[model samples]
Target: MKVQVNSIRAGNVIEYNGKLWVASKVQHISPGKGGAFVAIEAKALREGNKLQERFRSGETIERVHIDERECTYLFKDENGFTFMDKETFEQLVVGADVLDEDQSRWLQDGMEVTVSLYEGTPVGAELPKTVVLAVTEADAVVKGQTASSSYKPAIVEGGIRVMVPPHIGVGTRLVINTEEGTYMERAKD
Candidate 1:
């Protein structure tokens, strides 16, 4: 399918320069001196090479079709990540290289995720936007640091460090944005 440059969005797979690329970020630029165009940061679907391209308004690009399947994350082993199809219960093992850094850390057991397959092989994955994570270690609020809207570095359930509000303390269960690794809110649990 052909889609207008302005219509491109993150996660959209587009064909450019005779190569298949997945749009990771898209920005619409409207400068005072020039016509509008879309700036895209795309990664090659097969080779994982990243590139930036700009397309002028009214230009159309080919959109590649991908097959997505709903799967439940099982566990992470030395071999790779394992998942079971939600519908068929069939298991699939995917390599770590296929997932970006954020996805690798945020993936939790039994969490539902979308696996994108190309030519019957797993090529990509879509993780849930928000996840509940327990704060493992949060620095004690320094007396003077509280004067400003300061944040403290803390480690979460996955052993990844993130900047959190000063009030957040150890053992706090907070809602986290997996993509940005930012704190959203305190978890109800």
Candidate 2:
């Protein structure tokens, strides 16, 4: 599918020169004397090489079509990670390179994830936007510390470290923003 440059966004997969590329970043600009343009940073799917290119606002570009299927994580082994398609019960083994380190932290057995497939090959994985985790390690509140003072660094059950308010401690359940791996607030339930 051909789409205008202005419609591109990060995470979009496109084809150029007979190769596949994933857009890492995109910036739209409107110059004083010229039509608007878009600056894009893309990474090659085959070699992991990065490149920057610019395009006019309405320029047509090849957009790769990928199928997103819901899968449940099974486990990781020497063969990389394995997932099962929720609807078909078919299994897929994906390479470690396809899943980023940040996303790996939150992956657990039976966790639902969105797996992108291009021509029947796994291209990328998307985890939940947010997850609730239990704080496993945190500093004890100081004797005279107040709630408005400062936040303390804490490690969650999965070993991802984040900052939480002073009142929170080990064993407290908290909600986290997966995009930034940051603490949002105490978990209500």
Candidate 3:
């Protein structure tokens, strides 16, 4: 289906130049001297080559139609990441090539995710916007570094590093933004 350039998002597959490409990143830029445009970083699905393209906000692009299945993350093994269909209860093994390391790290056992399948093959997965994780490691607060803008580097449940507030410490449960891999706020529970 053809959609406006602004509608494109990361993890969307599109047909460009007669080739299938998966968007890795999308950014909207409105410069002072030029019209607003959407910048896309995409990777070729078959050739594995990456290309960056910019499209005017008014332009439309072809977005590939894919089947979105609600699946629950089971585990990761030598084969790859495994997920079970929530409805059918059938399992599907998605290769590492489909989901990057960072995206895979956010997966928790039994977490519901939307797996995008093209022609019955897994192409990508979408994770929740936020997740709750416990801080496993954190740097010691520096003297006189208690400024409101100061942030400390910390490690979360999946060994992912994130910049957290100075008050956050080991064992602190934090709400993390999965998409950007950043600390959002302290978890209520």
Candidate 4:
């Protein structure tokens, strides 16, 4: 699919210079003297290479279409992460290079994830926008820190740290934005 360069966002797969790349970062700049352009930092899908490119607002870019399937997390072992297709009951083992550290940290047993397939091969895994995790450790509120709204650092189940409100404490289940690793609110349930 062809899309305006400025419309591209992070995590979008695009084809540039006859190579498949995933946009890791996209920034739109409009200088006072120069025209508007979209700056993109993309990583190669097949090979682990990074590339930066700029495109004018009027320019179009090719967006690669990927097949997404809902798969249930099975386990992770010497063979890498294993996921089972819910509908077909097929098992897929994806490598660590494709899953990455950040994505793998949040993989909980029995969790469902969206696997992106490019030409029938697994390329990436997408986690839920928001995940509920319990706060494993929370810093104690300081004496004067409670005067205004402030955030404190805390650790979650995945060993990832997140800044949560001061009122939150250990054992509290908090709603978090997985992409940004920020606390949203206390889990209702």
Candidate 5:
């Protein structure tokens, strides 16, 4: 479907010049002396090559048709990661590269995630907004360190190291922001 450039957003798939691209970032700017313009950072959906393009704010652009469905992670094997279509009961296996850093860390079995599909081919995986993980190792809280405000590095059960408040200890369950990989707060047991 063709839509105005101003309507595009990051993660949107678009078609231009007979090629499919995913918008990595987009900015709409209105200079004080000129007409509004839209700048986009996009990556090729098939080749993974990146490019930057600009257009008049009202320019029409083609939006690629993709199917995004919620799926529950079933498991992973030598073949790749597998997820079950929540609505169809069909299983799909996506390669490792399709899952970026943040998604890879939280691919727990049975976790619900959004999988983007192009022509029924899995293109990307989206993780939850936040995830709770158990800290496997953390530095002990030093006595009389009440004034300390610095975060310390700690390893979670999955070996993902993130900074947590100094007061946190091993075996503590904590909620983390997946996008920033930062500690949110202690998880209620």
Candidate 6:
């Protein structure tokens, strides 16, 4: 499907230069002397090559259609991460080459993920916007550092490091934003 370049967003797959690329980041820039344009950083789907391009807001681009399926993360082993289809109970073993390391690290047991399929082949998976993880390690709060804007480095479940409010400590359950890998707030449950 053809769409305005300005409409492109991160995670959307598009065909550029006869190759399929997934947009990793998108930024809209409007300089003082030039018309607005969308800057995109994309990674090749099959070969994993990366490309950065800029497109005028008025230009159109080819966007590839990908099928998204709801799947539950089963487990990980030598074959890579395995997920079960919620509807058919079919199992899919997505290799590391297909699933980026950043995306795979966020997977938790039984977590619901949206698997992106191109031509029935799994390409990428999207985790929930926020995940609840218990802090495994946190830096000690220094005296007089209780300012509201202060944040400390902490390691959460899965060994993901995030900057959290100073009040957060080991064993605290925190809600983390998966997109930016940042702390949101204390997990209520």
- On lDDT, the leading prediction is 3
lDDT of 4 by residue, 1-189 (tens): 998887888777899999999787799999999799999998899997999998888899999999888999999998789999988999988888778887788889988998888898787888888889998999997878888888889999988899988888999999888777788889999
Worst 10 residues of 1 by lDDT: 94-103
Global lDDT of model 1: 0.87
Quote the lDDT for 157 in model 4. Answer: 93
Error of 1 at 79 (Å): 3.8
Give stretches of model 5 more than 4 Å off: 4-7, 24-41, 52-60
Candidate 4: regions farther than 4 A off: 30-33
Candidate 6: global Cα-lDDT?
A: 0.90
Instruction: Give the lDDT ranking, best first.
Output: 3, 6, 4, 1, 2, 5
Alpha-carbon RMSD, each predicted model = 1.9, 2.8, 1.3, 1.8, 3.1, 1.4
Q: Model 5: per-residue lDDT, tens digit, 1-189?
A: 999999998768899998998886798998999899999998788888888999997899999878998999999887778999999999989887666566688777798988889998887777898888999999987777678688889998789999998889998999988877889999987
Candidate 6 ranges beyond 4 A from true positions: none
Clashing pairs in 5: none
Instruction: Show model 2 residue runs off by greater than 4 Å.
Output: 25-41, 52-60, 143-149
Best by TM-score: 3
* TM-score of every candidate relative to the true structure: 0.90, 0.84, 0.95, 0.90, 0.82, 0.93
lDDT, model 1, position 117? 81
Q: Give model 5's TM-score versus the native structure.
A: 0.82
The number of residue pairs in model 4 that clash at the backbone is 0
lDDT of 2 by residue, 1-189 (tens): 999878887768999878898787799999999898999998788888888999988899999998989999999998888999999999998788777676788887898998889889887788888889999999988876684668889999878889898999889999898878888889999
Candidate 6 residue-wise lDDT, 72-130, digit = tens: 99999999899999999999888887677877878899999988889988877878999
